[model samples]
Target: MPGPAARDAQASGSPLIDTHGRVHRDLRISLTDRCSLRCTYCMPEQGNEWLARTSILGLDEIERVARVAAASGITTFRLTGGEPLLRTDIVEVVRRLAAVSGPDGPVQIAMTTNGIRLREVLPQLIDAGLSRLNISLDTLRRDRFRDLTRRDRLDEVLDGIAAARDCGLRPLKINAVAMRGVNDDEIVDLVEFAIAHDAQMRFIEQMPLDAGHTWDRSRMVTRDEILAALSARFTLTPVPGRGGAPAEKWALEGGPHTVGVIASVTAPFCGDCDRLRLTADGQLRNCLFSTTEYDLLPILRAGEGDDAIDAMLRSCVHGKLPGHAINDPAFLQPARGMNAIGG
Candidate 1:
């Protein structure tokens, strides 16, 4: 049950509104907490226990939740995971989500993947109505890739990126986490790689989501530093029209495409946050760093109707914090890692 504050907000007729007046419009759904690669930044080398099969939401339940959310104004849906592609029924999930329509039209469906298993499945996914992609490729060197993800699959990932382009996954975006000692030196090289593939690039500052809780600020390459590195090599200017987007955009002076930076640590964009997360285990989280979660699975499993589920979700959103307290002195790291929290 929600607290008194949430109840009061619901009385105002918009349960999704936080006290700060932010409206939720984007929903990130984690299909599974299972991944093919064990990225050092995401999970431990040995890894944590995986969720039980019975705990995860069924495809039908997922579609029902998505439909309710779409009707309530969540226009964008991003499928995440420990590795969403690891789910055997991922194509079927995409197909169901693609059919959910709002007043405007079909909901926009996107995915964030590691790209290891993407080469063979890219065509099926694209044909199943996946609209966009954000591939996580931290390094181009095979050895470095193996070290980062504990997997020697850089060749496969590169192949996947190329396949994504050939299949018309237009405006593809490559996401790279900028860590000081690890892959920071290759920022420019990554930019070049994106250019060659006709894909956009976004360099992100590493956050405190590692399973081992070993994240160090000193190792995090800030946005300013990334821009400085890029600027030293090429002319750069800001691109306009970034509303509530996590990434700040900049166009390369000589190129037609642009690059971006998601500086969550240095530049918090909580004021413009319009997104929420649904864990693979069927918990609704208002913020990525939230300590409390609203369980929707029990209601789903009990065969509650759409109205009952909708009201519960609304109450959950009303309890959202104004911002993730990343900069606060009393900030607390979430108990779950990025993998469990839906990335």
Candidate 2:
């Protein structure tokens, strides 16, 4: 039987439905395909090509697409990037998206950032209607952080986390990518750090989204391995009703603090996924691993109205595969890395 949330979603008359009967309500918008750090798991340390400034969508173009999405029943807009905080006009972006209204109400605004520049812009962002935050921090050790991201900005990230907490961003999520020989040893320690900061710690299993296409399955950490490492330190009580959210959450020791794992590889959750991604260059992606993308910039620039965008969105969702198919024998990594695709 469908739960109340599912039943309600079905009754909402949303057009963002796939052939598999999934109703899409979440949209991940990538502001830019540029980042300050080059995480080994995400991009190459050098020789990475970025989109031309003219090819990237402008603020007005982004808002128009978002407005169409909101009218089509998308309720939440998560702003991402190579690093969203890197965008100079991010606060204005939030202000614009927050003003967009859906059937339910004004759209919910959220962001996923590296946290290096968070402290400088968080106050302005909050004032501009930013509601939720997720900061990426892989390792607690400074030297390891430098090696993992090829940047010595761990202290800046930590300060950003503290600033976010002080600003009252409850359930402030700290995202860490789990790797086999790299930061896997810090899984339990990362969770403990989240507890100390009153934040929810989420560990994401590294996917084959690297710009260099050098991802090795043997070197990737699995969800079971992450859970096993945590179990040795604290009691984890599974939190039920994950719905469409990516992370599988667990309450630590049956209390307030909790930890989550986004097992994209080991335990795929494509059946209930409601996310639709809009790349910084105005490409619409059905799945993170999708090789196919529908370019929206030309249409928008060509003076096509909302009807055109709405049709494109429906067309994209209609073609959504049953799952990401990462486990398939024929699975191929996306041509663009996570930075370009939007994390």
Candidate 3:
């Protein structure tokens, strides 16, 4: 049964629509900011500050916000983190969220993990109604993987991926960040690996979300270069019907398997974006590159009702910019890096 907030939303309409006419439906909730690996592209090896345990949203608090969001017409929720599996109560988190239903029905619960601990917790997550998965895999080589992630757990990630596939996670997505002189040479190899594993391969353009703030446009691999490199190795027919999905996909060899490229930099898809982010500490972000945040934790902790929560969310969406102005000259990277921002 729909709660009051949800019933109100249905009675009227989703209050999540922005000035651009984009109805926000996807919510990326950061479970925690403490990660297991210090991926070079994501964060530094040391001196990284973790959010205070108390400041982080509690289980009930998270459920309250999610319930309000579900009522606001958030149909999909992706659990992300420094590494969500690190949370001791991750399964319980999933279970609680799985129970929240939106106007469309029970909200689709997905997760984006580093895959280091996926094998151990996947069964529990699946049982908790996790509907989809996206695992980060930059390179197939062990040495490169270690160098990229600064971790010697490449084997563990691979094992987890295998376990996920074996468990029948169809169209399993493997996300790889393409960097010049980093994993660019292995583009074809990664696709082949994904095909062998029966998983979809997605190459992402390294955005300006690194902790170091040293992202050089020249060093970052552009979408064209990635497509060109792949085109030389295999036949790629463009897959149509790309709506709001960040990835632009192509049918590989005209068959079931496909490859995707999230060209966030060169080819921005901000106009069709339907995502909102909730940081681990309970701040609401309208866009991934949004400079401003609407803090919801304080209100949640103050015993505010769902109406207040829903109003804050509606205001956040109402103030959303037409697009992330990365191409604009005055663009400034958000103070929080991707790790802290719930990417």
TM-score of each: 0.95, 0.96, 0.96
Cα RMSD of predicted structure 2: 3.8
Per-structure clash totals for the candidates: 0, 0, 0
Clashing pairs in 3: none
Task: Please estimate how well model 2 matches the true structure, expressed as its whole-model Cα lDDT.
Answer: 0.91
Over 85-137, each residue of candidate 2 has an lDDT whose tens digit, in order, gives 88888999999999999989999999999898888999999999999999999
What are the lDDT figures for the candidates, one per model? 0.88, 0.91, 0.90
Q: Which of candidates 1 and 3 reaches a greater TM-score?
A: 3
Residues 1-343 of candidate 3: C-alpha lDDT, one tens digit per residue: 9688555543323657787888888999999998988899889999998888889998998999899889778898999998999999999999999999987889988899989889999999999989899999999999998998898999999999998888886769999999999899999999999998899999999999987887888888999999999999889999999888899999998968999999998999999999999999999999989999999988998988787888889878878999899999999998888999997
User: How displaced is residue 137 in candidate 1, in Å?
Assistant: 0.3
lDDT-superior candidate, 1 or 2: 2
**Model 1 agreement with the true structure over 1-343: per-residue lDDT tens digits:** 9898766656423335666888788999999998888899899777488888999998999999999888777788999998999899999999999999876678999999988789888888888989999899999999999999998888888988988877777779999999988999999999999998999999999999887888888999998999999999889988888998999999998558899999998998989899989999999998888899999999899988888767877867778777788878898889889999996
Candidate 3 least-lDDT 10 residues: 6-15
TM-score of 2: 0.96
Off by over 4 Å in 3: 1-15
User: Where is model 1 more than 4 Å wrong at Cα?
Assistant: 1-15
